[model samples]
Target: MPLHPRPRALPTAFVAVLALLLAAGNGTWATTGAGAQDRAGSAPRPAALAGRVIVTVAGQQDAGRAAARAEVRARRVYRFALNGFAATLTEKQAARLANDPEVVGIFPDRTVSVAAQTLPKGVDRVDADRHPGAAIDGVDRGVDADIAILDTGIAPAHADLNVVGGKACVTGDATTRDIHTHGTHVAGSAAARDNGIGVVGVAPGARLYAVKVLSDSGGGTISDVVCGLDWVTANAATIDVANLSLAGGGPDGACGQPTTDPFHQAVCNTVAAGVPVVVAAGNTPGAGRDIASSNIVPATYAEAITVSAFTDFNGRPGGGGAAICAASGAVDDVFAPYSNFGADVDIAAPGTCTYSTLPNGGYGYKSGTSMAAGYVSGAVALYRAQNPGASPDAVRAWLLGTAQPQRSGFGFTGDKDAFAEPVLSLGDGSFPSPTPTTTATATASASATSTATAIRTATTNTATATRTPTATRTPTATARRTATKTPTRTPTRTPTRTPTRSLTATPTRTPTANTTATATATATATAFVSTPPPTATVVTATATATATATTGTTAAPYRVAASGRSANSNSSLYLYDRKPATVWISNPATTPPTVAFAYLDLGSAKPIGAVRWLVGADGTADSFRVQVSNDRATWINLTANPLANGPTGTWHELRITTTARYVRFYVTNPNADPRIGGFAEVEIWP
Candidate 1:
């Protein structure tokens, strides 16, 4: 006989809102006596409530068994974010659980929906396009951070995204693949790669982890959402940031201690684990407009960064642009008409007509506070890349601190609540250099010694001449070839000859004792026409003298006074340190078509023959140029064209003949792999 499989557990009912309103206890209960009747009779029991309820336990215990002890079937158990479980329970069963001292509170499971309606220009609206590290253009350089999208699963096959991994918490869904198109759209807005394809995201190329909480219909219960949060908290070490573009209706109140709001408690726990959460201020349906505190969940939680929506048709700050959604009454540079607003909202971002990737390798527009939250999530990723270990509170502070305030020309005209929240802006795209840990030093020694030997032969044929004792001389035909090549070779010989002539003249000025020295000098000078060996020797001597004339200068080895990023005092001494493992890296440019530069300042001007560097662990540069500057103000390129196709973990050498006080390395188009451009070691040879 074949056995039948057990039925899958499901929620009994889906409520619209789950409010947290604790009631005073009536009396103690005794299971074996009339006291139990008195306790049950004291409170006016509402007609047996039956549905799926979320039970928040007081401590970290077995949540599933806790529900079982109350005679309910647990559908899901949450461990990391909240010590709780979701179970199907009747009124008496839920009441019995509430009486247990270990149980915190029990509330009905509510519905949650995706907050989206979307675009690429939202990236520009947040000024992420202006940041070099953002790489908003279709460049390969990706943000070096991971972002988790908690929504209806992402499209696993989306070509434009770097979907690393995911987890599915919704019922009957084994994979975190988007069938609803909402989570995929949200993922694209947060970090679609800048691969010159369909569209780019705010934080281009950040690793995306899909945490599927909602289902294909773009809806799910609070239990499903909490299940996703539990997964996020468990993997908090790998996730740098999280984006929640979904919302639910609920009473606004503080979580923990006196009150028990499971959703808010889960969000707080997630933030405390170091992963910053960015959430959307919900959208009101139809023509209804309400403050965010009225219906938005997680938005009311102070632990997360709540984002409001603003319309930007032109991707700029000024008003008067054409409205894309005239039906919704959206005006350019103003708060989106359908967005929820109130003191709970932390910031605003572009959410109108957001162009982004959709399911099945497609792309389209979505409009909602969900899109706004995505922009903020991308910005948070950029920050996390620069500050790897920043706390959630620190991330929030930096984001708000760098934002463009309404008073500073980013203000929108029509917020119903009149709250002047700062608008997001990725300022200048430059970040503070990482603190120095260890120092590495490089000592370059270069010496050129040229030795020349000249032999002149003469033959005379004697023929008797009566009066003058003169002999008819037959000249012997002699041919000689000599070539001398020094590591430091200048293309122009005119300047070299001038210095050679002056040095020769000085030796000839000496009196009788220096007569032979003058002849030898003349012979070396004459060799400039027939042979370059002697001339090269004289030029090398002259170069040595000029180098010695400067203070703190040495003959062959050159000493570097300092090294750092161009036009910045932040020390990049690791570049000069001989250690190949130590590196000085720059944050990937938020925007593309920009350069990241670092410079080495020699104690004084010296001849630089070649620059050798080892590619850092982050990755290799796509193209680079070597520049020389006599004064740090003006620079001349030593390499006419950028060196391309750099290999990883290998030392690359660019041979050039130039003399300067400072040498700079410019990564014009950095490799998109690691995004952060840097060199492990740099050696400048004389």
Candidate 2:
């Protein structure tokens, strides 16, 4: 039978946009990895260990001789929701299909950069434009272009983001309505209309194409993701940018990595054909690599622009509404509470307390690097809308070309303003080599007083107190259980002729010999088990000097800082600013309680937000704000902090972290004040 103009909704469990991802998720990815690879030829290439995706052919391949040819090529390959093809091809089979003219293309299972958006300070409630929607962040906000946000799904009914071009994969019995609130939220961040409604997108007028990758629960593999990429690459002519707010087990985000990896390769394929693939970095901090290092996959590739997340200080609920999403603090990329972060993270953007559209037909708030990445996607659309003839490389050069310099702070902390250059002010690409130049910006006060904005002219100012990042090489996994015990063994032996004048009679090994042999065998097995194999688990963070903000002194049990408060269910882990303190109770039955502050700093956030399992030991199990007298010995902050409740669910702790010496303590009041708890690193920027 011949095919029709458009393929009907096949009853097969193919990949359609899963329910718009309502659950989630940036870094601004930037680099030219070609030089890096050329230099790294001696080193073995990083293992391609991303989860798998299968390719199908109309026919099967022959084994020994006269192999069969692929009769028909698949139009698109799906990922996340739609999974497992009937045809499981080996490397050779896959090679054959890749080379086949009839075959379309082999795609990866999922998009790189699943951890793009950092979880916002507020986990429970979310809505776009908490206050006013004005573009006062030094960037022109109005423009139109074509952008496709492939995620869970979107809510077309949302007043703010009246997105056009909404469609789902609708492969199976799934009615193809937005199930997860994710897709709608992401789309709203990217393409929400400028109409006086709820939220304002980065590029409000930009055309939208909703593409679902993950399912409603927000779990997905790689297949459906590849299908969405294929669609973008094929439709590059119509699409100025394709915002992929998803990642697999590996790297890349909101934009595909330029180097390799299936997703990044697809991004490269699109780049070759003049399209840009934007991706999300993911939600795992410290779990990923450093912002400039290895937390790899496509997002880290040179071509992609990974966007990190931040809270909207301008849109603080009842205050002024925000236009372009932006945060005003040094903890910009300080890792959203739940966002996964690492060195490969490129840049950061607004993600906290974001309100957007849902596919089913309503609106909601989404907090993750996913929201930040959407801002970049919309920005790209606007840029391409203005400069349609710009090359992929040119666009890449321009984004980083005009990116503001965000310095990584001291002590394994992440970077906030790494890509903090205002978009409108950014239009030039100067850094053509490994050494990127930093454009200056204003270091504004919390009150946002009218200060002299840091002007970044064509002047060369390398007078930077930038701390060179140091790599820590502690093996992530400890030794596994080694079996050690005496065991009985059986052995067979034959005696040889002695070197005496006469041949010696052989003593046959009997029951006693068997027992000794058994002991030897057991010892050998124990020794073999004792040795550990090399399982790589690298922890990435760049904590340098971070200046805590002195949020005006407040009373106890407050949610003032949004983050850093124990009273609230979730605390924003970005800034070092002091949060209102709550009380913690001491009970004989219950152990001491401590507040959590993530140390993930820099362009991307870090992991190590919460300490290990609670323990009696004070040092390892507490959260601290150190009062650095000299950078070495420090005092513990948050001591005797007030608590909101009886410390059943959790306790509230707050401290005013600053640039110089200050009164700092830990969350522990029962413990000696001389003994400080712990402090996860935060960040400061240029």
Q: Which candidate has the top score in TM-score?
A: 1
Global Cα lDDT for candidate 1: 0.59
Give the poorly placed runs of model 2, Cα more than 4 Å off. Answer: 1-52, 56-142, 166-176, 250-261, 285-295, 315-343, 407-686
Instruction: Report how far residue 581 has shifted in candidate 2, in Å.
Output: 45
Summarize candidate 2's per-residue lDDT along 1-686 as a digit string, tens digits: 11112222211100001112112112122122211122344522222111243342222322111124533233344222122131334555555544443332233444222332222222111121221122312233444466667776555555555455633442331332456677667776666666554555655545666665556655554545555666666565666776666543344333232223344445555555566666565554433333334343444445555555544434222223343344333242344554444434544555655666666455566566677677666556655665564455434433442343333120112333232322211212121122212221211111111111122235642111222122121111111011111111111222221211111122232221001111110001000000011111111111122322222111111111111222211212212221112111122224434332222112112111111111112243233332211121222221122221111112122122222211212244444333222222122211
Q: Write the per-residue lDDT of candidate 1 for residues 1-686, one digit (tens) a residue.
A: 11122222221100000011111122221212221222545532222224676777767667777777888778888888889888778768866775665666666677776765123667777777776667555666777777888888888888898988878889788889889888888788888888888888877888788888888887777788888778888887777787776555565445454134677778778877767778887777444245443545666666677788888887778887776544377778877877877766777888778888898898987888888888888888877676565566546545654566554565677776645666877755222222333221211122212111222235532111112111111111100001111121112222211211112212222122111111111111111111111111211112121122111111122435444463221225446443344555555445543456777766467765445566655344666656666555555554324454233455544433446777777666544543445676666655
Using all chains and alpha carbons, the TM-scores for the candidates as numbered come to 0.56, 0.43
lDDT of 1 at 590: 51
Q: What is the lDDT of residue 494 in candidate 2?
A: 20
lDDT of each: 0.59, 0.36
Q: How close is candidate 2 to the true structure, as a TM-score?
A: 0.43
The numbered model that scores best in lDDT is 1
Which residue runs does candidate 1 get wrong by more than 4 Å?
1-49, 117-119, 285-295, 323-327, 429-686
